[model samples]
Target: MTVALMWEARAADGRGAELLAWVRRQDLAPAPLRRETFRAPQDRVLVITWWDAPYDAALPELPDPPAESVTRAVHRWRFEAVTDH
Candidate 1:
């Protein structure tokens, strides 16, 4: 089964774009099968990566963003794909 990891962070005031750029530049390991990024109000950025492995598999994950660029702790969630179209 495939698995997806969702990571989110709220950038410090007026730093959303910078945070997203930094994230794009950082090297996340275990190259994902697919990846997507989203941004929202309040400087929130979310990144979801799909991996070719089970949910319980040990997958490489993105490291925490620089403290100065984040307003709150990073949030992460994992999901296993039940079906794919």
Candidate 2:
């Protein structure tokens, strides 16, 4: 079954762009990665990654990085492919 991983994070005060660039540099060879941003009243960012397979099966491991140092909050979601739909 294919899964889509949705990640939402808030960057530190003035480092949103920098953090985003860093994320784009990560090696996502086998799986594909796509990102988008939303402009709400309160500046917020959203990144959606589509994986042909489950996270543990196809996604690459991330390098050492401090969570609190870069993001304020994070969320992940997994979904099954809509084969019949």
Candidate 3:
């Protein structure tokens, strides 16, 4: 089975680019089968990583970005993936 890790953050005003760059440099432990990022309105950043593991398996996570770049605390979520195709 594959598990997905979802990480999200809201950047402080005018800091979305910096926040996105910081997150882009992060290393994913155990290596993900796939990964992607998205930018949303209101300076939001979303990162999704798909790992080759059981739904209940433990996975590495990206650390929080610098305080100066974010408006609020970061949020994280884990999901057991269903069929992708």
Candidate 4:
């Protein structure tokens, strides 16, 4: 089975670059099979990590950034791949 974890956050005013840099510096002990990052117009940063594990298996996820770096709590979601694409 394959699972994808999504994490999104909106940075504090004028701190988008800082937030993105912070996310880039994070390291996962047991890295995911694949990982990607993106940014949006509203100073939002998104990270998605793919893992070769069951949907309900324990997985490592990125932790929240420092309080002052974000406007609010981060958002996260998990999905299990249903196709071989």
Candidate 5:
């Protein structure tokens, strides 16, 4: 089944860009990563990524745990393909 993995993180001042750039360079084998940005009312930066891959193969890589003070949180979501008229 195809799944969509989503990740969100907030960085310190002048760190969001660097963090995003680092993520772009990461080699997420097996499946590719698609990133998007969202604006919060408080101006906090929010980044979301969608990855298409199998549940078993991608779960481990999706929520990559917290990286000390660099990443606040990593979220993941899995969705099954829907086909209907």
Candidate 6:
């Protein structure tokens, strides 16, 4: 099975660039099959990682940034691929 993990966060005030840099510096042990990063108008940063594993399997994910770097807690989600269609 294939699993995708989504991680999103909003940077504090005008610290979007700093937050993005911090996210890019993170390293995932046993890296995923694929990974991507994105940013939005509201200083929001998003990261998605694809892995070859069971839906319920424990997977590596980006951790939250330092308290002063973000406006709130990070958001995360996990989904299994639906390729039957």
Best by lDDT: 4
Q: Relative to the unseen true structure, what is the C-alpha lDDT of residue 83 in candidate 2, on a scale of 0 to 100?
A: 61
Tens-place lDDT digits, model 5, residues 9-82: 56545566565555555555554456565544322344454555666563434334236425455544555556
Off-target runs (Cα >4 Å) in candidate 6 are none
Distance from true position, residue 73, model 6, in Å?
0.6
Indicate whether candidate 5 or candidate 6 has the larger lDDT. 6
Q: Give per-residue lDDT, candidate 3, residue 32.
A: 93
> Each model's C-alpha lDDT?
0.90, 0.55, 0.91, 0.96, 0.51, 0.95
Candidate 3 residue pairs in clash (backbone atoms < 3 Å): none
lDDT (10s digit) by residue, model 3, range 1-82: 8888999999999999988898999988678999999999999999999988888887899898989889989999999868
Estimate TM-scores for all models: 0.92, 0.58, 0.91, 0.96, 0.54, 0.97
How many angstroms is residue 53 displaced in model 4 relative to the true structure, after the best TM-score fit?
0.2
Angstrom error at residue 82, model 1: 1.6
Candidate 1 per-residue lDDT, tens place, 20-42, comes to 99888866676899989899999
* Candidate 5 wrong stretches, greater than 4 Å: 33-71
Which one wins by lDDT: 1 or 3?
Answer: 3
Q: Which portions of model 2 miss their true places by more than 4 Å? A: 33-43, 54-58, 61-65, 83-85
> Distance (Å) between predicted and true CA of 23, model 4?
0.4
RMSD (Cα, Å) of model 4: 1.5
Task: Provide the lowest-lDDT 10-residue window in model 1.
Answer: 22-31
Q: Higher-TM-score candidate among 1 and 6?
A: 6
lDDT of 2 by residue, 1-85 (tens): 5666655556666766655666556665565655443433233445555666654665653343346435455555556668664
- Model 2 lDDT, full chain set: 0.55
User: What is the lDDT, from 0 to 100, of the residue 74 in candidate 5?
Assistant: 53
Error of 4 at 59 (Å): 0.6
User: lDDT: which is higher, 1 or 5?
Assistant: 1
As for candidate 6, its clashing pairs are: none
